[model samples]
Target: MNQPESSKSLFLGGAAKATAASREKYVPRMGEESALEEVLVEDVAPVRISAFVGLLVAISSFTAAVAKPMLVLPVLAIALCLFALRKHDGRTKPVGTLAARIGLVLACLFGSTGFFVHHLKSRTLGNQAVYFARQYLELAARGEESLAIELQKTKPNRQVATMQLNEAYSQDESAMEQLENFRSGAYVDVKKAGLDTEWELDRRPRVFQKYGREKVDTYWRDPSGKFNGVIQVELEWSPAYEGEEADWHVSLFQVERELIVAPSVL
Candidate 1:
C-alpha cells in the first residue's frame, strides 16, 4: 500500500519542511538510495574579533567613574563597537554584532555617568576646599586662633574640643603640629597682609584616595600679595548613604614654604 502525501515530510512528517533529497533519509524503504544527506547542514558566519574585544573594554569602562584618565576606556570601547557595526555586510548575521551593540550601550552608560560625576565632584569639592581655606585664614587674621584651628580639623576631631583650645593645641602634638604649620609661615604672612589677598590656584586641583578615604588638594598661591607662597588645602570625603553626597571637610592645611622672589616684583 502507498503511503498518503500527508505523511511524507521528513521533519514533521506532515506539512514539515523537507528537501527534495529527503527521500528515505534515516528510515528508508526497502530499496531507497537517496537519503537526507544535506538535511542537517548549517551555515554560521565568522565572529568578529574586534566586536568581542569591544564588549570586554566596554565592561571595563566602569573604571571611568574612579578618575578622569579612565574616561578613555569607554571612548575606545565605543569606537570599536561602531567600527564593528559598520563592518557588518548585511547578508550574514555577524556573530559578534549583538555583542558589539551591547558593548556600545554599556560604554555610553558608564562613560557619561563617570564624566558627569568627575566634573561635578571635582569642581564643587575644589571650590569647597578653597573657600574653607580662605575662611580659616580670615579667622586667623582676626586672631581667632581657636576658630581657625577648629576649621582645620575634621568634624569629629573638632567635636572633641572639651578642654581649652590652648591646652589642647599644646597637648595633641600631632594635630597641633599640623595646626601650627597653618598658623605660621604663609599663614602669618597672609594674616599680616590682611584678608584681601586674592587666592590664586597654582594648578588644577588634584584628587586621590588615601587610607580608603577620598582626598582632594587645592593648591593656592598668592605671589602678588604679601603671602608670596603656595599653600595646599586638603579635604577628605566622608561617605553618606541613601543618595546623599559624601561630606567633605578640612583634613590638612599645608603651606609650601619654598620662596620665590621675582625681580619684576621688586
Candidate 2:
C-alpha cells in the first residue's frame, strides 16, 4: 500500500537531525586530540657536519711529517672546532665535543713536530755540514794535510782550528802517504779549485740524518776546466755542556762518492 507523503517527510527529517547531533558531539574531541599531539612532539637538533670532518682531518694530519702540505690541517681543525662551539645553544647542542678536543690536541702535536723536523733537516744541520766541509777543504788546499785529516776524525779526535794552530801534528812520511791516499787526485783538484778558480755551488744534492749524525752531499763547479765534484760530509752535534751553543764536529768526510736523491729522508 502507498504511504502518505507528509508521514515519510517527517521520518526523514528526524533521521537527519540525529546524524547532525552525532557529528557535533565527536568532531571537536578528535580535533582537540590532534592539537595536543602536535604540542607534545619535540624538535631534534641536527649534527654539525664540520665537527666530524675536523676529527678526520686531525687524524690524517699525522702524515704532515712525510707530506708537508698536510701541515696546515691543524689550523683548519682548530677553526672548525671553534665554529662548532659557537653555534651550540640551548636548543641546538653540539654532538661530538670529545672528538673535537682530541682532534685539537693531536693536530697541535703533529703540526709542531713536523715543523721542528723540517727546520733541523733544512737549516740547522745543513749549515753545520757545509761550514765544516768548507773549513776542512780550505786547510787541505793550504797543505795542512795532517790537521785536515784530524778535522774529519770522530768527536774525540777532532780539534778546533784556532786551538790546534799552536800544537801541530809531527810532520813525517807516514802522514804524507796517508794524505796522498786519502786526498790525492780528485780531492786535491777540488781543494785547489777553491783557491784559484772561482767556483759556483752546483747544488746540495742530498741531506741526511742517520745514526746520530747529519750527512750532506754537496757539488761544486767552476769555469776553469769545468770542475765538477761531489763531496760527502758528516757532522755530529753534542749538547751544550761547557759552551752556550751545541758543539758540532765533523764525523766523516769523503770525495767523489755517488749522490743519491731519496724521496723520504725521514
Candidate 3:
C-alpha cells in the first residue's frame, strides 16, 4: 500500500511540470501582440492631425474664390500636411496620405481661378474706358462745348485733379484748341467716316507706366469688314471718396487716321 501511494504522488508532480512548460511557450507571443498594439496607437496620432488640417484647407480655399484676402490660408495648410507625410515614412497612416493629396489639389485649383477672375475684371474696365471715349467725342461733335468739358471733369481723385488741371493749362495749351476744332466741325470729314460709330476692341488693353491709367485700342470696321482706322483712348481711374462711387474718366483721345497716300507713280 505504501509503494502504490508514492507512485501516485510522482505522477501528479509530472503533470504540474507539463502545465508550466505550456505557459512558458506562449509568453513570447503575448509580448509580440502587446508591441503591435502599441505601434498601432502611435501611428493614429499623426493621421488625426492631418485630417483636421485638410478640412481647414478645403474650407479656406472655397472662401478665397470670392474673398481675395483669404487666399493665404490654403498655402499654410498645404505646407503643414507635407511635413506630416514626410515625418512618418513607412508607417504613414492612410487618412494622412489622403488628406495631403486633397489639400494639394484644392490649393492649385483655387489659385488658378483667382487669377482668371482678376483678368476678367481688367478687361471689363478696358471696355468701359472705350465707351466713355466715344461718348466724349459725340458730345463735342454736337457743339456742346460746356458739356464736353464737364465730361472731361468727371470724378477724379483730388491729387489727380490738381495734376491734370496744371497740365491742361500750362503744358498742353493745344488741348483746348483741339477741342475747339472738333466743336467747329473741323473734323466733319472724320464724322462722315463714321468717327462717331460704335467701335470694338482691337486687342487687350495695356496699363502704362503711369499709375491709375489704362490705354485701350479700338477699331471701327465697315459693314463689309473693311478696316477703317484705329482709335487710342487713355483713361484715369480714381478711388471712391466718401459717399461717392469709384469712377473712370477719359484723359486723352487720339485717332490714327488710315490715310490713302496713293503710291507715287513710278
Report the C-alpha displacement of residue 64, candidate 1, in angstroms: 4.2
**Residue pairs in steric clash, candidate 2?**
none
Q: Would you estimate the TM-scores of all the predictions? A: 0.61, 0.51, 0.45
Which digits, one per residue and each the tens of the lDDT, describe model 1 over residues 1-266?
87666665443644343544354233333335664333321223667888999999999999999977899999999999998887544455778889999999999999999999998987776677667666665666677666666765555556455667777667777767866666675557656767676667888778777876778887877756666667777777777867755566777766765668767853
Computed on alpha carbons, the lDDT of every model, listed in order, comes to 0.73, 0.63, 0.57
User: Against the true structure, what is every candidate's RMSD?
Assistant: 12.8, 12.1, 13.6
- Model 3 gets an lDDT of 0.57
Q: Model 1: what TM-score?
A: 0.61
Supply the TM-score for candidate 3.
0.45
Tell me the tens digit of each residue's lDDT in model 3 across 1-266.
Answer: 35687788898888989987665533332244365321333333344576558656755776666655566766666676675456554354555667777777777677667656656766786677667666755654555454444454556423343345435534556656755654454234235544445445666566443543344444333332433555555676665779788786666555655668988998
Encode model 2's per-residue lDDT on 12-36: one tens digit a residue. 9999999876655333322443653
Residue pairs in clash, model 1: none
- lDDT agreement of model 1 with the native: 0.73
Which parts of model 1 have CA positions greater than 4 angstroms off? 1-44, 49-53, 56-76, 79-83, 86-91, 159-163, 167-184, 196-204, 222-224, 241-249, 257-266
Name the candidate, 1 or 2, with the larger lDDT value: 1
Kindly give the stretch of ten consecutive residues in candidate 2 with the minimal lDDT sum.
35-44
Count the clashes in each prediction: 0, 0, 0
